[model samples]
Target: MSSIGTGYDLGLFFSPDGRLFQAEYAYKAVENGSTCIGIKCQDGVILALEKIVISKLLKPRANPRIGSVGRHIGIATTGFIPDGKHIVKRARDEANSWRDNYGSAVPGPVMADRLGNYVQLFTCYSSVRPFGVMSFVAAYDDLGPHLYMIEPNGVYWGYNGISAGKGRQIARNELEKLDFSTLKMKDAVKEAARIIYATHDEEHNKEHEIEMTWVGEETNGIHTAVPDDLLQEAEAYARRTVEGGEDEDVPMNE
Candidate 1:
């Protein structure tokens, strides 16, 4: 007998039936958290998240939901901010080390691979529990834009559109309707907002309750500021979509 203490105390690797119960438990933590969305388009990638503040006092203290992991890579998460921060810091350190040694920005997929390995280690060790965060990593590499979803189990893959945290399926459904081949950055932004607004209820879908960022060929680093004009457009789109209007057409750039 492995002497399972509380049934939930069976370590991260295996449960009573050889199931990775701890990983599922971590995912449950994610399903109870805020929503984060990522959409990869021809131009680049966009990240949007709902800001769920514990209290009004911490509204300003909560900060933005996205972080820069490298010169061209950024990340967003939907659970355990501290865990996300720690993992991001580790990613930064890894990127910095790779740059110092190889004189290059770590490739987006390479960074994801390294982080996945790091997360996998925790799942195998009883001393530390798996991170309760599900993250989206956005990068503009030589191969163009890439989006990745990484879970507590260290599973990661490039994605066209993805959502993490509560109501993720709703968000993914919205993304599924998008044609990645023809999507532009602006259209992607509105879609990102729409995903969050749609996933969350009216109480949590207010404008101020949303935080968003994007990166692309024209935009460098993480973009936290959405122009007032653009934000209003996104809101209108979300509103119309909710009111059962037709989806907007993809913008064709010359």
Candidate 2:
């Protein structure tokens, strides 16, 4: 018998096999999304997203995949972008609430935890569907730079490096080979660009753009878009590495 109309129809119910089918579907949605990568460097954190261009006529920069929370935190998302934006709005609200109540910027871990709880709420009620998105939150706080990934199921975890979407497995394998202890932030940026390029499926024949952001000493601990010159340089390097078959080479500091 097909279980399509049974427990899978609602996020509030679980199937006999101890699975939340709705949540699993939400995860599948994320897996099919555009790729996003997060790397925690010695001095800071990096967030990168592959923005698929649906139409050439679409205004450039009309929709950004990355957003800021307060002054110090930045978030990047994969999966349904509208759902991601909703989560961004909630994150900003939470940051504002924390600052208003405590007279301080919200910490990275606290922001991630609150957002996780908020996303999880959707799965608990029959009135709402699970968010079809996964988010990466990056921040530089008193404890230092932090990187976290929040899943659709409401779980979030701190990671040295993480990837989501269609190219996650390839991106993760590349991320694992890096030694962050000695890796500089600039190198991390180049590496982020490189991994994105490496994971791209040329056969898919889709137009795409790279969007990156960081929170670190270079930005004075503020979350902001990567500078155009630097970003362009990283993209160029990525292309060269991928085409020249030089994947093992580490980026040298300029």
**What CA RMSD would you report for each candidate?**
3.2, 1.9
Model 2, 202: alpha-carbon shift in Å?
A: 0.8
* TM-score, one value per model: 0.87, 0.95
Clashes of 1: 0
lDDT of 1 by residue, 1-254 (tens): 45345765567656556677787778888888788888888898888888865566775525866888766888888888888888888888999999999999898899899989998887887888899999888888778898998899999988999888887889888889999999888888788877777887666444346677778865854434555567667867776787778555533233
Model 1 clash pairs are: none
Q: Which runs in model 1 stand beyond 4 Å of their true positions?
A: 1-5, 58-62, 203-208, 220-225, 244-254
lDDT of 2 by residue, 64-182 (tens): 88999999999998998899999999999999999999999999999999999999998888888999999999999989999999999999999999999999999999999999887
Give the best candidate by TM-score: 2
Evaluated against the true structure, the overall lDDT of model 2 is 0.91
Cα displacement (Å) at residue 249, model 2: 3.3
